[model samples]
Target: MEIQEKKNIYVGVQTTQTRDIRDFFMEIDSYKNILVFAEVGEDKVCDNSLELLGEANRLKNIRNNDSFVIAALVGHNVKKYAPTLFGYGADKVVAFDSPMLEVYRSDLYGEALAGIVRTYHPEIVLVGATALGSELAPTVAAKLRTGLAAHCTALKILDNGQFTQVVPAFGGKVLGDIYIPNHRPQIASIKAGITKKLDYAPKDGVVEDFSCELNGFERMKVTKVEKETETCKSLNEADCIVVGGFGIGSKEEWSKLEELASLLGGANGCTRPVLDAGWVSNEKAMIGTSGVAVRPKAYLGIGVSGAAHHTCGIKDSGLIISINKDENAPIFACSDYKVVADYKKIVPALIEELKARKG
Candidate 1:
């Protein structure tokens, strides 16, 4: 069997006694539901899981009854999280409960997820592009022999049940629209905070048990689990954000941004270069096409060069205020209020003014 790739599209050649692309396309309509991985963290469903659920609900609304939204949850004592999942817009939840499945093991979780996909064929599968999801989504996709659009910034469902995945490429310089027409369960691991969390309204939904057999933790040994000490603020839920870019300069100036964020009672975010420069602790604090997408009430970009990739994340923001040294910076075009000045001088003055006004 030969697979031809032309401009990011994969075309499968016919093989003896194998399903061709046409066969898969013909079978596409039969596949129902937009499935999402309801990943549990510390016995609760994470925000990213809910974000995917909300997005899936939108697509299901567009597709109508032809496609329902379902969540595949795997964990020990995780059935309790199903109500939240349903309230967030899942039609049904498949709970895989077992002691061995408590912690995330790639082999066991992948096998169980693959089994669920085989048993109940869904047209689309969504996972949060978190640490676990990054590891698991690819594994499931490989096991099922399907295409996965990783870290997609946006999604659109066509009339024919096809998905157009939007993501950044070439160091966040360009947006790429990816389509996987000849695949079942169009899998994508969307970055956290790209989609809004669904409004909580409890509804009538079924939680069915999904059983998976697992060996006694023999495949992989977990000697110790060390959680990262630093936790970045959730940009998705922030009403205001203070973002820094490459122009922010030095670690000291980055700390000043943090103080500004604190003064505004919001979070501190950064562009890709800031994150790459180790100015921020985690990728969650980075906002761009390749990073987290935020829709804040007020966004203050300090010393930032507004690249297309960075603007894509904050385009949905309500009021944008940009401070830059260059008057001709592209960021000024998007800013509601633009100040041409050295951010190092202006930021300290602004902080003092804000303090004085509050005092």
Candidate 2:
């Protein structure tokens, strides 16, 4: 028995160059519309999903002329969030209400999104870089045999009709721009907090209900979903951060740093090396590029070397103060205030001063 080749349809991310190539072969004439997947939670859409909708709305204005933004939302109570999406700029919302989508299962959610893409034939697809989004986007792209760019920090529609996607690379030391040079519906996942969500006046956009019947094979069976305990505090969301580096010496010595953080009503963090040394968990590590990017009211760097990777992460902080023995440390360049002394002596003394003040 021999298999036969089916009709070759480009089922993936589309770019300007790809469009031109497709145009030469008359494939561009079959172009459809853009589609954005809204990651629906139980009661609210994730913030990144709203951000994607805002970006989609912006892209639609540039390309559509008369076309509208199509938002595909999957989950129970998806309809309830359609109005908010409209207020945020979705011209049309395709609600796929289902019990299976209530909790994010990769198999079920991916299949649902893939089915919608096949039905609508969107020219582009955008997703957020959330845990669920990361799982669903790649699967959907693979099922549809399309290209995908992940963790995109920037997105723009070029004049020539191509979507340029930018992401951080080289351990966040540099930025890389990617494009699907030849594909159908261009797919990209944007990282959270990269784009601002817009607040637009509510428009009388249409909301359509979409229903699909899945057979035993087509329907995914989810046996169990285990939730992990969120033990680490998100440094990015913290108001104040106390950072310790090699100068702190040992894990036992970190107590002084913690005392200072407690005095200031802040959380204690460490550099990458300190965390790797079993001094602290990665969650409490506040190293530069590879770790969480923080913008706090006050960031105190204790005995930190201030590598480009670490410095970049805390550059957005409101006030940066560094205490290191090396007067020429790189951290001093970016620190708003610097103390040239041994952090072992300085941190303990500072904690005492804070405690005395409170007394």
Best candidate (score: lDDT): 1
RMSD of each: 5.1, 8.7
Over 4 Å off, model 1: 1-29, 216-219, 229-237
Q: What C-alpha lDDT does candidate 2 achieve relative to the native structure?
A: 0.73
Count clashing residue pairs per candidate: 0, 11
Q: Candidate 2: where is the Cα deviation over 4 Å?
A: 1-34, 61-67, 200-203, 216-221, 226-237, 243-258, 268-295, 300-317, 320-346
The TM-score measured for candidate 1 stands at 0.87
Which tens-of-lDDT digit does each residue in 197-218 have in candidate 1? 7899999888989875566424
The lDDT values for all models are 0.82, 0.73
> Who wins the TM-score comparison?
1
Candidate 2 TM-score versus the reference: 0.73
Cα-based lDDT at residue 320, candidate 2: 93
